[model samples]
Target: MAINLAILGATGAVGQELLRLLEARALPLGELRLLASPRSAGRQLQFRGETRTVQAVSPESFEGIDVAIFSAGGGTSREWAPIAASKGACVIDNSSAWRMDPEVPLVVPECNLEAGRARPKGIIANPNCSTIQMVVALKPLHDAAGVKRVVVATYQAISGAGARAIEAFQEQCRAAANGEAVDPGPLKGQLAQNLLMHWSVDEASGYQEEELKMVHETRKILGDESIQVSPTAVRVPVLHAHSESLTIELGRPMDAAEARTLLAAAPGITLVDDFAAGAYPTPLTAAGTDPVYVGRIREDVGNPGGLQMWVVSDNLRKGAALNAVQIAEGLFA
Candidate 1:
């Protein structure tokens, strides 16, 4: 049955990707309503082939909608997700608002598809960009060799911040080309020619929020509190894809060849680990794809039972909107 659907924050990057992927991914679609801030009211965005006007979201906006996919900020989601849920629409939120909530399900379909059934709050939370890609790559290995600990560092793309930040990055790059001082928009410094040790600061924790998201969300989705995670989230000059360097300690030694074989057969994983051929997943190559690309597979000699790998994916796709759509479409699957 074709049901009514709404894309909250339709003007934002993730929301816009949801619009494109609604038909590109060929997920179940019905009457598509675009909802955004009042500033975006009357703005028309092309979907599939038709033009749809984006509306300002209200409590009543979800009345006839069967599903609401929200990519608006956390505050917007905190205020409106319940309102949408109370209206009878199943919400798949792309914000952090409801992720760790006891009532909501934070899901990564490949790792915890069954958790989708536990949404008493009528809202499903999408995992963070870094967590989504990391877990997708980690799941296969974790199942094969009991993963004991994970130490990862992320090279996050600016798009994970937002579309405006991406524009600011481009502007900075242009200025750099002209030998001029670059301007930082939402970021504290120019991300064009620099790297930041921290992405989103969480002063109390003394760690980047992205790193914390990876640690907490990994444990939640994996359902393994024993899986110790230490992460350092860094922001690079890349425009779109999020990449991670992982060191996974297993209960027993698993050689690189065996790890490669397992990842090769894992769902949603594309293995391109041919160091001899000089081929591997890079942010430039992974910018607009679905699969979480895994490579740089090697055995950590220091710990015989450990393996090291690199994971990359389009943060907008698997990390946010596409993961939300995957969970939403699985309702029909």
Candidate 2:
């Protein structure tokens, strides 16, 4: 059964990845519409061996569309998601706008695809990129041992910021290599050979918005509001993929071997946990990949009975575009 599809923010980074996944994945396709802001209206994108010109988004863009994937910013999603839903399209929005809305289901297909089926607002949200990968890695253990608390420190990539941030980082790197002064564009400070906690901060909570997303979004996706999440999100100089060091406390006492067995059999996870050989998942290993890579599964020495691990995934792929496409696949295909 072929379905008509519309991609909002078609000229943006995640939107372009959505186009590539649509071509590579098994989504029965009908008519495809590429939409963006008026500035990107005339630009052409290549898909399925044909050139598709992007059109400016408007009320009529959702007409006859079955599933609309919104990769634009939250403002655009807040404005257009309901409009798209009203026109009978199931909207999968990748933004912070609707994830916390009780009416909208925040979905990571592997973890909560069924929650997506009962969307009261007809909008399904893609979780924060950082949250998406963390939840995916935690789901299997969570189900097996009941996750009680998580302390996560994220090393996020510049690509997670946006396409422009990537260019800025590259330029900064070049400048640094030449012993020249650096310019931080779309970033607070130099990201080349540097680290930053650059996400918007809530002065009251003293937590960056990115870190807070992990806190609330984790509870929501795991369907346990009582679960505790302590997060610290930092930006690294990496070009792609986000990495996290997680210290998890579970309900029951589970050793590293037991956790490894469960994760090895879980969906959307690839284990590279040969610690003796110094093998562990890393940003470079996960870039351009779809699966959440987990390694260094060990009992937390400090906590005595808790678990620790390293997780990594491409922020743009599994973290954003690929996750949205997977939700659409589960719902429509």
Candidate 3:
């Protein structure tokens, strides 16, 4: 059944990717609506070989919308998601607003597409971008060997911050090359040649909000509250595709070759593991791609029974827009 759909925050980075995926993917489509803030109204964007003008979203904009995908900031989602849901749209949100909400299901289609069917509030929360890639890589392992703990350190891309952050990083790169002062516009500090742990801080736990999201969201999506996740999220000097080094402890001992075989067969995963030949996934290679690239699979020698691997994916694609689209596809199509 073809359905009517709307994109909230349609001019932003993830929103733009959503448009591209809608054009590229096979989603039964009836009507497509592009929406944004009042200031962005009248802007023209190309879709399905047609020009669609961005409209300043109003209550009536969602009147007949079957699904509303939001990539705006948290405040916009908190304010508008429910409104859209009330107007008969299944709201798939790409912000932190409803992620931890008990009433809302935080979903990654590969890990838990079934959780999306019982949306009491007519809203499904997209898991954090970092969380989305990690869980997708690990879920198969968890199903096969029962994952116990995960210690992850992320090398995230600046594009995860926003389009403005990408522009800022480029400017900082030019300045660094010229030995001029680098100004971090939305990034807060020099990111041209430097790494940062700059997501919002939680005063009590002292963990960046990004790290905390991995810990909790991983548990929620995997349906295992006892699974421990220690995460360190660092913003790296990359343009797209977020990468992570994960050390996983499982219930039963699983060797590298076994883990490799499992990941090779997992859905939404691309295995490029042959480290002896110097093949592994990287941000540059993963840019503009969909699959979560998994490589460098090996046994954790220190932990004896644990495994270690590297994961990378286009944060804007699988991490945000594509995941939301997949949810709507599974639910409606």
Q: What is the lDDT of every predicted structure here?
A: 0.88, 0.93, 0.94
Quick one: how many clashes does candidate 1 have?
0
lDDT of 3 at 7: 94
Q: State every prediction's TM-score relative to the real structure.
A: 0.97, 0.98, 0.99
TM-score of 2: 0.98
Worst 10-residue stretch by lDDT in candidate 2? Answer: 11-20
TM-score leaderboard ranking:
3, 2, 1
lDDT of 1 by residue, 1-333 (tens): 776889999999999788778878756677788999999999989887888898999887999898899999999999999999999998999988888998888898888888888789899999898999999998988888778899998999999889898888889999999999888777668787799764667999798787888888998888888899999988899989999999999878899999999999988999989878998899999988889999999999778868999999999999998898898778743
RMSD of each: 1.2, 0.9, 0.8
How do the residues 1-333 of candidate 2 rate in per-residue lDDT, one tens digit apiece? 999999998888788778888889988999999999999988999998999999999999999999999999999999999999999999999989999999999999889999999998989999999999999989999998899999999999988888788888889999999999999789879888889987999999999998999999999999999899999999998988999999999998889999999999999999999989989999998998899999999999999779999999999899999999899889898
The order of the candidates by lDDT, greatest first, is 3, 2, 1
Please estimate how well model 1 matches the true structure, expressed as its whole-model Cα lDDT.
0.88
Residue 40 lDDT in model 2?
A: 92
Question: How does residue 64 of candidate 2 score in lDDT?
Answer: 97
The lDDT of model 3 is: 0.94
Q: Which of the two candidates, 2 or 3, achieves a greater lDDT against the reference? A: 3
